[model samples]
Target: MDWKTITQIDRRYLYIILFIFVSIPLLSPLNLPILVGEHAQAMYDTTETLSAGDIVVCSFDFGPATIPENRPQAKGFLFQARELGLRVVATAFWASGGPLGEDILRDVYGSDFPAIPEYGTDVVYLGYIPGNEVGMQTFGDDTWTAKGTDHYGTPMADIPLMQDTRAAEDLSLWCEITSGTPGEQQVIQFVQGRHGGPAALPLVVGSTAVSVPGMMPFYAAGQIVGILNGLSGAGEYESLLAGAYGYPTELLAPLDAQSVAHVIVILFIIAGNISYVLTRSSGGKEK
Candidate 1:
């Protein structure tokens, strides 16, 4: 093809090709092997260390826009927690996160796993609280005081899971699945900061790709124990869940699609470079 044609390839054609590259994997996943990152492994290890009956406070800090990336990490964490017989006290700093947590719990309990525990006793949803950072501080001081009722409006005193759990100090671990601020920072300031000495609550985070860079410093400093970043992180967590607990690999279709899509984009860049070089070389020969 001429230099102009090679360089000015129709955008429509590129979109079509991109669509195919992304869609084929969704339809029939390649099941490509993913090298799990240290962050995800750390998350797994941190979770595995929790003993049964330990109180884990999970904060769904992201809105629906980030569900694709955040949901899998939520499922992976919850699955591990449930399998290990951990008591999960779920809440949300963001208003929307409450229902999202509820949906996650419903899916997990409704799944084929027969041994999954019931909601109130094993898992409790505290729903959303207002006042952002201030609300986080309130929860850190006293969970029932901040959220008087569960998502269903039942008094916290009536919930079986809330009977003994009262504040951040009672939590064995804190897991935050977030896409924005008032996430790791708030958790650190209110929850982790309030606890005395070296016995601070351990925290793990699952964040969107856009927010992962900012959270790395905390991970490095050991303020946050583990991180699950974007879709790739979710995929790695999924792989861990499958290998560790025998969950289905088919659940990783999004991860497979992501891998193929990335490869396709990289290939396109290489092809474009090759075409440009060849076109220039041909022009030089003709001259």
Candidate 2:
């Protein structure tokens, strides 16, 4: 192929190549080895530390726009939580987050994973609570006050899991799968703040790539025990589950596609640079 042609390749051709690179891995997932980051590993370790019957609060503090990145983290957390036999109290601050949390529970703990805890008994969805930080504080003060009813509108007093666990103070761990504001910040300000630190409530945050940088400070400060940063973090968590706990890996197809796409992008970048260099050298020689 001519150097000029390589340098001036049509955008459509690039799109087609990218599509193939992304689609193939998704259609047929490869069990590519992923290096679990410190954050993901920490999250895994925290989940493992929970004893059966211990209550852990899981907050879906994001919207549908971040589902692609946040969903895998949610699945990873739920899988680990269930495997460890911990009681999960699911809730959301964002309006759309409630349904998204429900979807994660259904997909992760539903028919696919038959041995998970029963809803309302071992796992309960408290749905969305308004008032952002204020609502988080209310949950800290009294869980039932912030979310008096489960997602299904059943009173918290009716659910076995919710009967004794009244607030963030009663829980062993606090996990947040978030994308933007009203997520880690609110959890830190209200949940962690109420308890004094991670030692008190053990906060774990799973955030999108864009939000990870801002959250690293908390991770470093020990305010949050663990974190899952974006899709790569999700992939790392998946690797941990499959390798350590023998969990299924079929749901990790998107991560495989992401890895392949990154490689394809790097290759294209190198090729374009080489083509540009050759094109410039040829022009210099002609001059």
Candidate 3:
């Protein structure tokens, strides 16, 4: 048996296999178990502390580029807030994030049973605040002073929810569904940092996978109470919501594909290593 052949499986074949693996779950979710992460748990727990009618700042700091990860993260939180009767202040910092956040908000808040949530009272949209980190600082200091209008071009004064929000301090929680710029770091420095340490307003981050490592120190320092780390974070938070509050899993289809793809990749790696070892034992030279 030419052991070398095992090491030379066609790249196209691998691609086909992976594509099949991913497609199967995407088409029909396998209900794979997604173990909850500590960061996700922290996010859930921090949110649980707030009471009904408490205000939550749901900042969609990601754009279309990060929708795959941030969409479910935002949706899960929005669902939770709606269920618990928490008022949400939906806004975005990234220019593109504005419309994207509006869509997510619509999906979660749209209801037929009791009619859709009242826009100005149940949730308020601030659209996209420009200036990145500087914009965050300005908005954090005084919400309406920087942007006198909400997303709909309606004057802030017309929105009753705006009355409760003069600054970040007036809100109960800061949830940054972020990808970059005015993301976790900016929130830590400008939003959370503005308040007193130890007694500062609690924050949660729904970050892209790559950004999670850099944000961990802040999480450890207690500056951030919870983190939704990438698509997996969304899955974990969704799972918790499904289990604890009996909410249906909205991202299960994508998450099942993600889990299957990961498993397939790992199995291939193990097979490759075993083949390499056998080849070495058969007098094959290592490259």
Q: How many steric overlaps are in each model, in order?
A: 0, 0, 0
Candidate of highest TM-score: 3
Model 3 clashing residue pairs (backbone): none
Query: Model 3 lDDT vs. the true structure?
Result: 0.85
lDDT of each: 0.83, 0.84, 0.85
Tell how far residue 27 is off in model 3, in angstroms. 2.2
> How well does candidate 1 match the true structure in TM-score terms?
0.88
Each model's Cα RMSD: 3.7, 3.4, 2.6
* Candidate 2 or 1, higher lDDT: 2
lDDT of 2 by residue, 1-287 (tens): 77555866778999999999899978888867678789889999988988999999888988989998898888889889988889888889988898888888888778642235588777888889999989988998888888778877788778888887887778899899999878988888877887656787888888898889988788888988888989988888888999988877654688889888889999999888777788777773311
Ranking by TM-score: 3, 1, 2
lDDT ranking of the models: 3, 2, 1
Task: Give Cα distance to truth, residue 171, candidate 1, Å.
Answer: 0.6
What are the TM-scores, per candidate, against the unseen true structure?
0.88, 0.86, 0.90
Native-vs-model 2 lDDT? 0.84
